[model samples]
Target chain A: MAKKVNSLKYEFIKGLWVENPVLISLLGLCPTLAVTVSAVNGLAMGLATTFVLTSSSIIISLIRKFIPHQVRIASYIVIIATFVTVADRFLAAWFPPISKELGPYIPLIVVNCLILGRQEAFSSKNNSGRAILDALGMGSGFILVLVALGGVREILGSGAFFGFTILGDWFNPWMVMILPPGAFLTLGFFVAGVNWLNERRAAQ
Target chain B: MKLILLFISAAIVNNFVLSYFLGICPFVGVSKKVSSAVSMGMAVTFVMVIAAAVTWLIYHLILVPFGVEILEYVSFILVIASLVQLVEMFIRKVSKPLYDTLGIFLPLITTNCAIMGLALFSVLREYNFIESIFFGIGAGAGFTLALVLMAGIREELELADVPKHFQGAAITMIVAGSLALAFMGFAGLISI
Candidate 1:
């Protein structure tokens, strides 16, 4: 029994990198691709998702024993949706511009598989403390990927980072880097590049 | 005439899948076979239309009247969830073959994001009931178009020799990027 609990830590840590939500699991790709055109947007989205994920995970874990297996998924979604509503309203009321830039993607967080996936896979069976840890790790992993993608796109597309100019007049922005195609191409290469790095590491 | 423009604009000019990035999970997951893609498309279209109508009423009748607009996300998602359940049972009882075709996809539609995005976009744009319906249909058509086109490409891609790393999702993304570039031609069509 003690050994089993120890392995839960491993599961929690795996979500942070070994099976990172954006990079490895490949869940929640829509928001990951849609909102990363700018670093600020990406950071805001990541934090918003983290708030929802962490809160919902704790709630679900606390109530996991009560929810029926058949209706567990539905229950989890309702919990997530409720938290998402809170996050959405908070952002809209306080940070209207980021909310506007994010558009429907904010509400679309309810549909993000990462939050629900963690609840079903981890929180439902784990204690509250473990669930919280797992949620935080997964949330951080997601934020890391979004920040990296956002940084790349912002620098290449606008020669800026987080809306501040880093590259001077010598830099001619690649207009495509900020467009829809840029999102897809950049993510594709990023995935391939990550896989290449992992392969090299494994060989050594 | 207005409806036609709305349909065309949603379906082509601002495609939900390619341009807006809605319904991408199914756009990637269910686009492997043309038949399943069609089924998934139809299921999504059905859900989107209902979601738009229902969410519109909820927003106006409930959220706005009560001044609890903060509950929009919670209410919209709940509405979508129950609606999908209702659609599933209705299909299962009415027609077995239809249910089988759309069975698994129906539950998935509850979280498709395209349906939710349609509802949210309609509200954001302040469209009337008729316009919202049109928007839903148009978005569905656009999703279907992209899914079918992608399925066709992937079918042929099976025969081609591809690099190992770019085999599964990387190639799909690269292809989708090109497709997005192609669709950008329609950007000049509608000013919206």
Candidate 2:
């Protein structure tokens, strides 16, 4: 029906703005805060998560009916862990430097609440087509926020963007921005900004 | 002396929550009240110690010896998930009062990432059995310290007229940033 198709489109678009995972749902803060100290690291982490999220979404959607109610959580985790291992090994074998930079985080993705949350919340209920769309939508939203966070921290903390000097000679990088405190502070402001924008849009 | 240094480093200098960002979920989610934060901290610390010991054995004994180190992530997560369940069941059987306090938080620990980070970090640093135990205590202590401090601040923050937009997690994160800045003072105390 036209109504069903429109609702599906709404589901996909919501993830980008209305239901931005990092800012709104706040599902996966561990990796979001940890890896986004730089743009590239954030991008790598986001992409790897996207691959895992989308693949796992498809698989889980397909098998949702077969998974017993009692063991569904465990089953979902196992499926997610398998894909995470693949992503981990691929990164280590190919992009050794990026892999090193990410350190344990690539493996830590196994516990990233976002991927698990998606499977539990969206994929298990929806058909494969909608599950895939939801995965891609949420993944894109996650990637966008991560890249933005990384860019803010990178430019402010290091006076660079993706390792390139963007702020020029006049700027003295705020060392704290690249440090642990900076991650929290930048995210805090970004979250506030998103909330303000949403409030204003609702008011109109 | 060496063990003391390792403990101090893990607890203060290189805190799991503040510096490494291991357990932000519970750090933010459950720190609404000091009492619950302490409860969650204890549960995590308890699991961290057991997980460290078990994971170390699995890696050094099963995975490493069998030449299947590639199963590290999968195995570690599985170990942690079941361990949380085991700990939950054990507590319910042993003490009803204790379970009442920590009952809900037990299942949530499976995805806490702090436990998994503990397992992975111990392995990464190649900490032996004894060192790993101490490391678990230290990290858990650090997590507890941060959670309790955050809870204390948030209790007062409820009274403060924070801007509406930064009311929930946003404000908490900023406070955490300031706490992190304060924690950085400990960096000079130890190099590691």
Candidate No. with top TM-score: 2
Please provide TM-scores, in order, for all candidate models, with all chains considered together.
0.96, 0.98
What value does the lDDT take at residue A85 in candidate 1?
82
Q: Write the per-residue lDDT of candidate 1 for residues B1-192, one digit (tens) a residue.
A: 999999999999999988888888898889889999999999999888888899999999989999998788778888899999999999999999999999889988877889889988998899998899999999999999999999999999999998877878888888898899899889979866
Candidate 1 regions exceeding 4 Å error are A1-12
Off by over 4 Å in 2: A1-6
Q: List the residue pairs that clash in candidate 2.
A: none
In candidate 1, position B143 carries an lDDT of 92
